[model samples]
Target: MNPLHVDLGVTGSVLDVVRAPAGVLSTPSPPVDPTAPEVVQLAADLVATMRVSPGCVGLAAPQVGVAAQVFCVDVSAHPKTRTSHGTFVLCNAEVVEASRNERAREGCMSVPDLTGDVKRATRLVVRGRVPLTGAEVTVTTDAFEARALQHEIDHCAGLLFLDRVAGAHALHQRQTYL
Candidate 1:
């Protein structure tokens, strides 16, 4: 199901993406209270911003300058997407299980202009609570969706794709990344 449909009726401006030097990107995000009205609004804002950005499947709150465990992901129209769960938002996400490591090219909104090869789990099960309802959610999948989840989870942990690159040779600078 597409969780992006959650509209809090509060208008939220698209937040600017924070870059490398910004402490927001490097600092570990604090867990958001599931029942807080503000966090619910933030989740809606995340979905709104992600929808307007081209070629972006996922966005972490840190990428948008918020140091909290909030993120939105949607693999809907991407050609590489397999087993996509559509758009969804999760607060206070935790990776419960991960297996099957695979190296693949990755890009980030926070670290633009560079796409690096990072090894990530091909299969993952991530658990989190919805911001407004406090309901627990479990996402289990593989392929591009799995990669997207891992990427956002990394952001919550204050790690960038560069941190996972296997030495300087594995990194690449490019104009675009998917």
Candidate 2:
């Protein structure tokens, strides 16, 4: 069964996304109880925020000024998506396995004006707990879904695509928001 399909059974408020240089964005988040009410609400809020943001495939707690290891992802609508699990939230997510390095362009809601070329694993296996039930799940995916997972995981670790870039040469100014 796809663990990403769990429902929080609550309406989520769309929270404002914080920009880069914010202390929360750079500071690593600590793990929280996946079954905690606050964590469940945070997970819902993340999904709500990501849904409202155009071109956003994922959103992490730090992006909304929360320093917790929680995030939501949905790459089903993306053209580049190859193996998606639909929409889901994960707490304390960690990459258990990763292979196939591939460099690709990445954008962030927190860094609205810039996009970076960052190398990420195209194949990955992640272990995390579902938000409401605290059920541990292992997601094995490839292509864009893999990239999205890694991106949000990085946010939980207080790192951005900018940090993964090789240099200034790998950065580009956004001409339009996608």
Highest TM-score: which candidate? 2
Error of 1 at 70 (Å): 0.6
How much lDDT does each candidate structure score?
0.85, 0.94
* Top lDDT model: 2
lDDT tens digits, residues 1-178, model 1? 4443454566766877788978888889999897798888888888888989888999999888888899999998999987888888888898899999999999887777788999999999999987777888888889899999988988988989999999989878877436
TM-score of each: 0.92, 0.97
lDDT of 1 at 140: 88
Candidate 2 positional error at 106, Å: 0.3
RMSD of each: 2.3, 1.2
Q: How well is each residue in 1-178 modelled by candidate 2, as lDDT tens digits? A: 5656888988999999999999999999999999999999999889998999988999999999999999999999999988889999999999999999999999999999999999999999999999989999999999999999999999999999999999999999987736
